[model samples]
Target: MPPRSPAEDRAAADSDTAAAGREQTRQRVIEAAIGLLEREGRDAVTTRAVAVAAGVQAPAIYRLFGDKNGLLEAVAEYGFAAFLAAKHVDPDPQDPVEDLKAGWDLAVEFGLANPALYTLMYSEPGNATSAAFTAGMEILMGRIRRLAAGGWLRVDEQLAATLIHATARGAVLTWLSLPEDERNPALLTALRTAMVTAVTNQQPAVRDAGPAGAARALRAALPEQTTLSSAEQQLLREWLDRLAADG
Candidate 1:
């Protein structure tokens, strides 16, 4: 080996710095892509579209993500990461119930705000790594496991948690499909209460006629979004299937 010149050392440092900067820009592009998908349908998203939304050039997207498929994959990963961060969901050590509630609320809010991104993060066949998805699941499941271990959860920990999540997600999606008038505050309250009851050993009023009836009434009151195309219907069907399979 030989000693490098001062210029070479500076060049090496600059290379590392530039790599870091590129990574940051790449992350930004992915985030922007996710936001675009959330606002519009997934079909509306394209490489040029993502670059324009990300405030980067089309060439820059190719350089960062390699291709449209690659960019979409990155966007999936970005979706999960952003969901976790946006939820401000801290992993609780002491109180599992509180932890679960916090996670659920954040997840619901994210789904309500960005249905496309929410579905893609978990259900869509995208480039999201299995480990990445596992870690995301653990963020919510860790609490349920802890509660089960402590005998805080009434039913089978895994099954109960899955149901609670499914119910919450379905309820939220159903609500989103409705007109503003169809968003019933009473139903929302009941569903929230029922969700809490389902997870925790402590029974709430929502466990009985409250959540179940409210959910039914909410459904009855809602009319289909005529704007939903055949593709969107198929997308929702696949998403529901994925949820069932995951459970």
Candidate 2:
């Protein structure tokens, strides 16, 4: 590559500084909006209010986020990023089922702790496409894959992921809907256990459980196998996926 001239280097440095400043402003605005949402509910998160809280002009919000809706989208993404940061991932847990349970509990705990942020992040279906949300899902899928690799998964990986996510969301929403005096910790425990039972087998399904367990285990481990060619692995994966889904 050709070396940049001094003028070009100065221009690039200026661009970098400008980009960093913009990101800092965005973070400030997002944090301010989140504070308003948590303290005064969604209606208080207006562009004017956020700008005031962020110590910026109202037009700065428009320049940074386009509009209130766009600002909300950014807030939801920030919430997901916060949730993802709190998550503890165990790549090789001694007990995959326990790991799954812990993961679900952590998600529910986060929702319970940040009811306003959680509701805002989850209430809109479009936020599911956020990068942070996608990253969190990837973590959940990794846990599910671990269960499958251990022959502990009762359902297909995709279905298992859905069940786990749905249960956590339902638990959080249901808990938040109840009066504080009426709220019960048992409800969370019951939902968590039910989700676990719904998605996992008590024993390794690969042995006497069924062929589906074996298929799932094989499918989960397929990518790590060195013996298969790329084409062979692809074909095997298709077959295993079909078998795993059969249950």
Candidate 3:
């Protein structure tokens, strides 16, 4: 390949600088939208208001995010990124079940800390398809997978995920809705304990030595099962993973 000329190199550098500037402007807009949403509720996050808050023209918001809904989605994504940044996930923990509880607590705390942002991200149903929401789901699934690997799960992986999300969402929204004097810490504790009971087996499959245990054991040994075709093994592994987690 021919080396780039000085003019070409300068053009590339200028393009890079412009791209970085655009991204920085986008971040400023997102931060302004978030502040508006949290301070004055969702209805106050108009493009005009955001432009004034961000010290940018209204057209710039449209150019960067496409529309008002797009801007709100960006704000939601920013909230998710901020929350995830504060969280610490252990890939390998001594006790997967405790790890699960800690993760749940962290999620609930995030929601409580940023009620407006959490409502914007989660109050609606369609957000499941958003990139940020999907990233969060992937993290939740990893925790569920760890439970499965440890033979502590008591429900199908998908169902377990749903249960965990439902419980946490309910706890956060319900707590937020309560009057200050009526808010009880027991509500959170009860929900967390209930989630644990509902999703995890009392005796881990590793210790129970039963069908669930056998299913879990088989799932763990799946990589060594060379008799099955690759596709067949994958299918079997999925079944075993479900069975191992099933109550």
Candidate 4:
């Protein structure tokens, strides 16, 4: 390869500087929006409001996020990233059921602490496509996989994930809807326990002769098995998934 000319080097440096500046501005705006959402609720998070809070012109918000909806999406993505950071992942827990409980509690706590931001993050179905949201889901799925591997999962892995999400979201929304005098900590505890019972077995189901438990264990382990060809493993996974879902 030929060495770069002085002009080319300068152009590249300028591009890098501009990109860094853009990202810094994006961060500033997102933080401002988050502050507004948490303090004054979602209705207070207008583009004009965020731009002023971020110390940038209103046009900058439009340039970076397109519109109010786009800006809210970025704020929701930030909320997901914050929640994901708070999660404590234990890849190989001594008790997957306890691990599940801890994870669910962390999620509910996050939502309760940031009610407005949490509502904005989850109220729109489209927000689920954000990279941060997807990353959070991947972490949840990993936890579910561990449960399946230990024969603790009682439902399909997908169903387990759905139940976990549904319960936590419901808990947060319900708590937020109630008067301060009516809000019960027992409701949260009951929901968490119910979620655990709905999705997991008290004992490792692998000890049983049932196909569901065996299939779940095998499916969890399949990715590590090299005895089968790629095609064979894929086919086996489909069959095992079907059996696992029967639970």
lDDT of 3 by residue, 1-247 (tens): 9999999999999999999999999999999999999999999999999999999999999999999999988887788788778778788888988999999999999999999999998866666677767877888888887787677877777878999999999999999999989999999999999999999887677777666656765665566558999999989977876665554
What is the TM-score (0 to 1) of candidate 4? 0.94
Question: Whose lDDT is higher: candidate 2's or candidate 4's?
Answer: 2
Worst 10 residues of 3 by lDDT: 216-225
Global Cα lDDT for candidate 3: 0.86
Model 2: per-residue lDDT, tens digit, 1-247?
A: 9999999999999999999999999999999999999999999999999999999999999999999999999999999999999999888999999898899999999999999999999999999999999999999999998898989999988889999999999999999999999899999999999998999998999887588999999898887889989999999988988887777
Q: TM-score: which is higher, 2 or 3? A: 2
| lDDT score for candidate 2 against the true structure | 0.94
Better of 1 and 3 by TM-score: 3
lDDT of 1 at 163: 72
Q: Candidate 2 regions off by >4 Å?
A: 1-11
Query: How do all the candidates rank in terms of TM-score, highest first?
Result: 4, 2, 3, 1
The residue-level lDDT of candidate 3 at 115 comes to 92
Q: What TM-score fits each model? A: 0.66, 0.94, 0.91, 0.94
Candidate 3 residues lying further than 4 Å off, grouped into runs, are 220-228, 238-246
Better of 1 and 2 by TM-score: 2
Residue runs of model 1 more than 4 Å from their true location after superposition: 1-4, 87-95, 123-132, 203-247
Q: What is the descending lDDT order?
A: 2, 4, 3, 1
- Model 1 lDDT per residue over 1-247, tens place: 9999999999999999999999988988888887788788788789888888888989999888789877877767766666766655444466667777667777777777777876666565543455555676776666665554444554444566677777777777777778998798676567767877766666321244343332322222223445667787666545533432331
Could you give candidate 4's per-residue lDDT for residues 1-247 as a string of tens digits? 9999999999999999999999999999999999998899888998888989999999999999999998988889899999989988887888888888999999999999999999999999999998989988998999999998888888888889999999999999999999999999999999999999999988889888678987987898887779999999999999998897787
Query: Largest lDDT belongs to which candidate?
Result: 2
